[model samples]
Target: MECGIFHTPYMRPGRTDKETFEYSMMLAKAADSFGYRDFMVGEHGMQAWENIPNPELLIVAAAQVTERMRFAPMAHIVPLHNPSSLAVQVGYTSQLLQDRYFLGVGAGSWENEAVLRGQPGDLSEAHPRLLEGLEVMDKVWRRQPFTHEGQFYKAAWLEAGIEAGSVDHHDAFDLKDGEEYHALADHSPYGGADGLEIAITGLSAGSPSHVLAGQRGWTPVSFYGGSTLLRSQWDVYSAAVEARGDVPDGSRFKVARDVFVAKTDEEAKEQAKNGALGHAWSKYLMPVYKKYRILQGFIDDADVKVDINDVDLDYLADHVWLCGSPETVMAKIERTFEQTGFRYGQIAVNTHDALDDPAPWVESLRLFATEVVANIEVAGSKSPVHEFA
Candidate 1:
């Protein structure tokens, strides 16, 4: 039962971008002092509404302030960029962090990003393109010169410059010019063998492709819904890995979600209920739900009556949020653990995250770590609870 913080900064219209950036880092540093396992950040670029455009830069700054906290860009928009170059950037960053960095890649969204790049829909469906991207990217990181001539891009470059004077140009390859494949592998900003960890997400439900991910032994992640969903995903993926008779690096399976905590149950509820901005946020999100799937209630048949277009403030306050006083939060936290055995938490201590100010949210997380998490961990409780996982 390890705990950690996770966030997407919930780019509200009123919050200043700089304030958002500072507040995010501040929370990261705070999470470190509290002995959190990790501080993960999400990335969104070229979107005016989503502030934290580049998570890697933020992680670099966060790394300077916190000593104990492990940090990673929760996910990087990989589909839009040059895959090989992105891999190199990851490699270089890993080197800078002394091999502390991990890479989470996903196909790009954001219509503006695609339009700016003159693309259509999303690059996620182009599975072969994405696969080729990872192949070339990993080869570059390992500094292994391999020729690729499948679909997307082709290259024959080695880590060593020109394979010791055997080739002189980019197109020059041993297969063609009677020289082994070669290229320059330098310690660039985010490239080369400082132990780069690559995790590809969205493996699809129960698909055999998931077994391939298990083969590489990289972490897999998914969003949407609550804790049970994450645990089940990890279990299925882990089981598949085990079925292959390969002992996975057990730590690779992770579950993440937005969380906020407070000192007392009363304060926690007050902070969350009073911070009704979640209603406003929900208004903007209803269509995405309609397009995909609706949110079902979690635990104990908590019925919430709210219109899709007009999410009830009270309904969201009670149903969607995982905020409460230490005792209450502990109960919910314990329920989550007993139900799914999820070991990580992405605590959202920022005020805007709960439609409140920063102070209350931060206080909540500190109290949770001190009281609730402490009790459960110490008691070694094994109370069973119902869960979707």
Candidate 2:
């Protein structure tokens, strides 16, 4: 039961983008000091409400402040860019981090992002495009010349300049051919590695990406989903892994949940219920669900008679959020594992603008690490909790 943090950099009423950026980095540094396993930042292109156009840049800055925490761009919206370009960027960043970076790729999901890019604001085409983009990246990173033909993208005899003495003069420079002949691989950012860790996210339960994860041994992550949906995703992932003659393990499965913690259960609930967590669902998420007519996708029970139009903050808090004192929060996570069969799973705490004042937010994060994580780790050993100064 490892813990990680994912920040969405949610914009609130009065907080400037600068303030949000600083606050997010502050929390990430705290996670570093607390010995969390990893820190991940998400990328969004057009949505002003949740803005952080290039999470990779932020991860680079964070790497300077943290000593051991691994960083990832939670999911670079794959359909928006050329895979070849993204692959080089990712490869360069991985080498810069000295292999401390992981890649998470997904189809662009937010409606504004898709429409801004002149594509239908739907998931239908994005999935195949995402697959093609990843395939191109794979071919490009193999350190050789390659070609790809796909419905969404294609490459014709592009060379990586990785093979010894295979450098092309055109790839060397834009200057008149008199310029010094140099290979891109001669100055390759990744010293010699072929690739880095790869992960895929499923926008929907049991998506084709889950099968890809199983086939490729890539980690699978689901964002802010209920246990029922997560279990369905794991079922699909496990079946695919078995089909490929590999054993599936929960160690690599990650589930992100909206979490807040406090010194006491009552205080925690009061803060979450009255602060940004409450407002985020009521004002932003649920409204979007209703507008898109996809509220059913988020609800825990499909048979229940409920109106998506009438869904409110309380319903979301009870079903989706993991909020309480350390003990209560740990219990909820344990139950999530039991229900979803994520026995060796990692818990990614999804952070947003939970409060206007950053004090409670910082305190809540500290408590989660010092108390909830300490207790959960010891419970497995049937040993006494480690004393902290």
Candidate 3:
């Protein structure tokens, strides 16, 4: 299995923007040094506890300090911005990073986030807009003139332009506000720019959004789930892919986990209880989820039902978190994959404030790379997998 780091950049108390940003970048840089596959950052505007408004900027900054590791914004909220503008920015970003980045798009998730971003739609309304917005972006990235008129968004295609040095051509495209184009003419030798890998984040088990991912042959990233929940998501994605006559490959899937590691299981659990990881969920996340009425998933799992009021660090450490020594955590990960049959998917570990101490956190990442990942064996596919075969 390929391993990667997924940073949410949850701003915690006692840390300034500059400190948090610098520390987060340090994690990304460390991931690169440790030879992780990819580094993904998240975005959450107006949520002071999770301050990154544009993850792309973080990716750009991380790119300068690291080499070889692919960088991505875990998602760009689709409904809050013009799709055409998003297309241009992402396309340019891909080019700037030498096609070493992927785009993760999602409908606005939280109602509060939507309100904060000036998009006050509910989740139901955001879904259709996410679909339409992606359609618009896809059309624009084809490097050809096209027009789109959908329920949520409209785009008029602009023809490709002449070389930057050429004075013969006038820019004919009327771009969306803050959008610009940079591409050779359609007939130029370099006309076919590098295509981007687009992945969609499936936040809930069996989300209908997975169907879009399947139809488009994009990667399905399961956000924060154990084996059972992630398996349900894969089932949904696989069925949708099969419906379109495509093979379902587990290697293309991604699973996100919240992890913290130390020299031993006891030490790890203790640190998790006392560290920034503990502070974030207890103080900021739980309260917001409770206030917003979105704690059902975290509170009620398939095998357990715990009252939100009674949930604590001990409960979380046992149920949701992967906190232990390298060997201990590796065993848990092995069990998760064994249960879910996630053979070759990217096992993405969510970044925690556990790294704020620097020594233990860095050691954990290094140990994960050296001791855990080195010993894990992936079940490789011998042939193109068909439905249920």
Candidate 4:
């Protein structure tokens, strides 16, 4: 399986934006040097914990510092911006990165983000808006002059300057007799003949995003969801693809997980529970998860009897996180593959802030990259693990 890093950069308070960005760059460089295939960064507007409103900027910067690692916005929240503007930006970034860029789009999931944008904070319209936005972007990328009059957004580029001949006026600056005017330049993504790859992420069971991924032949990303949700996502994705007379390729599916590796199972567990991962979950993510009522899904999936309130770091370490020695983490990955019956092509390690001292955090990444990844197999074939000199 291909391994990568998914960075939300759940940075705690008190750090400058520049500091946060540099930290992300550090992770990107590390992942790239470690032979990761891709690096995904999240976009959030309102939340301080998950900062980095425009992940495209980060990806652009990351592309300069790292070679061979592809980059994408874990997702750009579609409902939060004008689709036309976003389309141009995405196109420009894709052109800049060439083959190293893909697009990840999402309907806004956080209610506060909606409220911050002066909306009702209801996500009922988010999905529809997302679809409309994507349609607008698709039209833009096709290099066609078209008009869209959708319920959420209206866009038109039906007139081209080239279609109208230049006026015979001497006032025109530096105009030659034979000088020809041109239409708007093409702003399509740069991914050779197949076009740019679009990835959509799903966190809940029976997520429509996965179905949409299948229908559009975009990459399907399962983000930090448990076994049940993973299976459900694959089921819906595969069903949609088959219904459309297309085969579902597991190689396009990406599964993001909170992972950490140490010298031993006990050492990894202690670090994960007491270190940055534990603090981030307790202080930031758990509250959001509780607010969204997402814990019940995990509870039901695990068949646990603990109260949602009581679900602490210990619970997460035991049930959710792949924290252990290389051997133990490999076993967990193998189990997940067997349980879901889907040999997902990519394993995106959900990254967290390393906080003050970066030794343990960096060590975890090194071990995961060098050791755990080397011994893992996907679909009965050993991975081409990189050998560090």
Each model's TM-score?
A: 0.76, 0.84, 0.83, 0.91
Model 1 stretches with alpha carbons more than 4 Å out: 14-17, 109-112, 122-126, 158-185, 188-194, 200-213, 224-228, 247-252, 276-280, 283-291, 297-311, 337-356, 376-389
Question: Candidate 1: lDDT over CA atoms?
Answer: 0.56
List the global CA lDDT of all models. 0.56, 0.71, 0.72, 0.81
Q: Write the per-residue lDDT of candidate 2 for residues 1-389, one digit (tens) a residue.
A: 56777776566646666776787778888777766666888888667667788888888888999887788888898888788788778887888897678888888678778777777877577877787887787666665667677887877544533443446652433435655433445222354434567777775667677788898888887774556667778889999999989988877877677788888877888788788777777667667655544456556442344566666666555555678888888887787767776664566777778545777877877777678866664223211113222
Over 127-203, each residue of candidate 4 has an lDDT whose tens digit, in order, gives 99899999898888776779899898998876655334346653445545766555477677896325889999887
When sorted by lDDT, best at the front, the candidate numbers are 4, 3, 2, 1
Candidate whose TM-score is highest: 4
lDDT score, residue 359, model 3? 73
- Residue range 76-183, candidate 1, lDDT tens digits: 765566777777677666666754466676654456666665666555444555667777776666655577776667666643544444545545334567554444
Instruction: Report the alpha-carbon TM-score of model 3 versus the true structure.
Output: 0.83
Extract clashing residue pairs from model 3: 11-49
Arranged by TM-score, best first: 4, 2, 3, 1
lDDT of 2 at 157: 41
RMSD of each: 6.8, 4.8, 6.8, 3.0
- Give the runs in model 2 whose Cα sits over 4 Å from its true position: 13-16, 156-182, 186-195, 289-311, 377-389
The prediction achieving the highest lDDT against the true structure is: 4
